[model samples]
Target: YLYNGAAYLESTFAAFKQRLVPVNVNYRYTDAELVYLLDNSDAEVLVVDTAFVANVARILAELPNVKLIIEVDELGEGPNPAGATIAGLVHYGAAIAAAAPAPHIERSLEDLWFLYTGGTTGMPKGVMWPHRSLIGSGGPTFKPFGFAVPQSIDEFAALALTVHDGAHDPIRLLPAAPLMHGTSAIASWGVLNSAGSVVLLTSRSFDAAELLSTVQRRAVTNLTIVGDAFAKPMIAELEAAEERGEPYDLSSLRLVVSSGVMWSQQTKEALLARADVACADLLGSSEGVGFANSVAKRNRLAPTARFRLGPDAQVFNDAGERVVPGSGERGVLAVGGPIPIGYYKDSAKSAETFRTFEGRVWSVPGDFATVEADGTITLLGRGSVCINTAGEKVFAEEVEETLKRHPDVHDANVVGVPDEKWGNAVVAVIGLEPGVGATEGTEAELRTHCRATLAGYKIPKRIIFVDSVLRGPNGKADYRWAAAVASDDR
Candidate 1:
C-alpha cells in the first residue's frame, strides 16, 4: 500500500511529508484540521470534495488569496449544486496532463494515486494509487492523452448515463473533510486525473472562522462537506450566531456538496437555506456503488427499478443468483467495471468485500440496497446495523427515526441489548433538544411518545437519556461509542 499524496504538499515541504510516509500511510482529520493543513501548505489551487462545502465555505473568509477552486465530480457526470460554470471545469485527468503547449509534459498510470478510507472508525490512512488502477466505471475516466471528465450538467449527467466522450476538466478540489478517507481522496483523484491542482488543508486547525475568512478573502468558489458531521455543526454555528444577530457573509461560494454519510432531512434543508447557490448530497462507498442526490432532486428510487451499471456493474444474491431487485427485495451491492484491488495486505478481508460473480469479478461493500426499475438505488443502511429482536427483524434506523420525532428529542441511537424475555431487546440512547433537561424519569415520557408512534416491536424497551451524545469529527453517531456509553450509563 504505497502512498502517493505528494502532490498535495507544497514543493518545498513535499520532501518532508514523503520521508515520514512509508508504504501504507493514513491522513485522517476533521474539516477544522483540514483547513489548517490546507492553509499551512499555502496551496494556490484547491481541489475540493463536493461534500464539505458547509464546513469550508464560510472559512473561505480567512484565506487571503487563492486562484482556483476545483470541485471533483467522482461519477464524472451529474447535476451540480453550482449554477453551471461556462467552460473552466474538468476532471482530474484532463486538467492535469493536457500539454497543448508543454509537449514535454507527460503522465502515466505509474503516477501517484491517492486513497481514502473511513477514518472516524479508525485512524485515517492514505493508500498510494497508480494511474493504471484508476479506470472504468469503478475508476476515474481515463484517456490516451490523459484522464478526462464532463464539464457541465449537460456533459456530466449525460456522460454518466452514456459513454463519456473524453471531455471533462480535471475538477480540482479543496476537500473540507479529512483527506484520509476514500470519499474525499476519490474526489481529489477526479481532479488529479486531469492533472488539476489539489489545494491542501494541512493546518491542525480547521476552524469555521478560518475557513469563512479564507473563502471571502480567497474568492473560493467550491466547498464540500462529509455528511452531517461537518455540515450540521457549521450551520449550527452560523445559526447560533444569527440568532444572536451576528452577521456572516457566505455569498462568494458557488457549490456545496455533502456525502460519505447521509444528511438528515433537517440538516439537508438547513444547509440549502444557507446557500444562494447549489447544494448536493451523495451516497456511495469505497468498495461498492456510488450515486449522488440534490436538495431539489432528493436522490431516490422506486423499489421495482433495475439499474445497469453499464458493463461496469451487475447484481447477485447469496446463492449467486442474479438478485434482480423487485418486490422490495434487496441484494448485496457489487461493482465490476472498475473494482478496487482489494484491501492492502488483507486478501481475506478483500475477498470478503471483493468477490467474483457471474463471468466477471465483483466487489460487494456489504451494503443492502434495492435498485428500482427506473435505475435508482434505494440504500437501506449497513447490514451489520440491522436489528433482529424477537421473531421480527427491523432496521435500527427505522426505530431511530421514530425516536427523533419526539419533538423533545434531538437525536437517538437504537441498539439491541440482551434480554431474557425477548432475546436482544431494543434499547435507545437519546439526546434531547437543547435547553430541555433530562430527568431520570425522562425515558418514560419518550417511551409513551414512541408507543403512540411506532409498532410494538419497533418501540424501544429501554430509553436512556443523556445530556449529549458523543460523535466523531464526522458527526456520525458512533454505535460503538454509544454502546460503551450506554453500558456505562446503565
Candidate 2:
C-alpha cells in the first residue's frame, strides 16, 4: 500500500482478511526502486494514491504481475495521471462501495507477513514472519488495559467489544511515523485490534505543528514516532508553542512510543518536562521486535543507549557464545523468541542472520551492543554499518549520536571510507542547524567535542557539512547516500 498513515488501513485490513500479503513501498523511493520492490515482491495488486500515479505509470509495463491498480482519490477530483490507464484500474472509494463484502476466512497463526527492510546497508530485503510470531513479538506489549489474549478469533471479537467497557476507554492513537514503516503499521494494528481508533495526520510531510494540533484536536491517547528525527522537531514545536502562550493541550496523551532509531535521553527528558506522558523507546527491527526496551517518565528517565533486555533477548559474541554481562565484551544482540523466519529470497543472508546456537534459534540483525553489570544492554548501533579503523570497531550510530548531541549539528550520518593510514577512516556527514554555518574551524570544533566522550580513533577523521542529511520518511539514516558523499570527499 502506497498511501499515507491510516489512509490505507481499509485496504490493508481487506488484504489481511483475504490472505493477500501487503507489500510496503516507501513513498520516497524513485521509480526504479518502486518497480524493483513491487516486481521482487511479485505483487498482484497495487493500491496507491493519486500523487504516486505518475511514478507507478512509468514502471507499470515492467510489473506484469501487478494485474490491478486501485487508485485512492485523496484529492476528491480523481486525478488520473497521463499514461496510467490500465485495464483493471479502479478507484478505492468506489470499489469499496460497489463490491460485496468478502466472507471471513479462517486465519491461521502460520499465515505469512512480509516487511521490507529500509535498505540502509544495501538493497531492500523482505523479512518473512508468521502471523503468530509477529503477534507474539509485539502483542504482549500492546495488550489493552485489564485484558488478556483471546484464544480464538471469536473470543477476540468478544473481548474487543468489551475492551472499552466498564472503566477502560478505547485507545486513540496517532502514528506520526509513516505507515509504510513497520514501526507505525504494527502499532496502529495493535490499537485497531483492541477496538480503538487511529488518528492520522493529513499533511504529506512531517509537520510537527500539524501533528501536535491533530493530537490536541483528536484527544489522542497514544503517539508513535521514529526516534529523534520526529521527537526533536516535535519538541521544538511544543517549546515554540509554549513560548507564544499557545501551548497545545497534550494532557490526553498518555504514551509516546518510538522505535527503529536512536532516541536521545535529552529529547525524552525535554518531552517529559512538558507533559506527564510516558516515553517508550523500543529497540527492534524488521527482522523482529523487542530486542530491548527503555521507558522514560517524569524524573525517571533512563540513560541514552541503555535498554532493559527484552524477553528471550541476549548478546552473542563472534564464537556464538552468549556474552556474559559486565564481562566488557561487545557482541551482537539477538532475540530467540517470536522472530522472523528469514529474509525472503536470500538464503545465504538468511542463514547468516538467523541461526541455531546452543539448541535455540535466534535472529541477529547485526545490532552491536554490550551488557552492563545490571544486565541492561547498551546499543552500539548496527554492525552492518559499523566502521573498522585500525582493527578497532566503531559503530556508526554511536558517532552519529555524539555528533547530533552538538549544539550546532542538526543531524549527522557516520560512515567508513577507505583510508591508507586507518584502513577504514571514520567520516562524519553532518547537517548543521539552520543559521549555523560551518566556519573554518567548525570541523576541528566537532572533533574536539567528540574527543571528550569518544576514543580518538572513534572521532571522525573528516567532517563534511551538507544542507541536509539524507533520511527516509521513517527517519532512518541513509548510509548509502552518506557513503557516496564520503567517497566524493575522498
In terms of TM-score, the best-performing candidate is 2
TM-score of 2: 0.95
lDDT tens per residue, model 1, 1-490: 1112343332212322233211212223455555544454353455544343334454565655545555444434443454144124333444556734333333343444334444324432233344344433323323422424443335435544333454543333556765545555556555443444455453443556555555556555557676545665677677876897864676766566566554566665565576565565655565633432434323431111112343455555678766565645667766665445665545666667767787666767665666667655555556667767887766676577567756687777887776788778788888887789888778887878878856788778877878776664444567776677666765
Q: What is candidate 1's CA lDDT for residue 60? A: 62
lDDT tens digits, residue span 183-202, model 2 = 88888777787778899888
Q: What TM-score against the true fold does each predicted structure earn?
A: 0.63, 0.95
Q: Candidate 1 at residue 396, lDDT?
A: 70
The models' CA-based lDDT, in order, is 0.54, 0.84
Which parts of model 1 have CA positions greater than 4 angstroms off? 1-130, 133-172, 195-206, 240-246, 288-315, 321-326, 372-375, 401-408, 439-455
Worst 10 contiguous positions by lDDT, candidate 2:
141-150
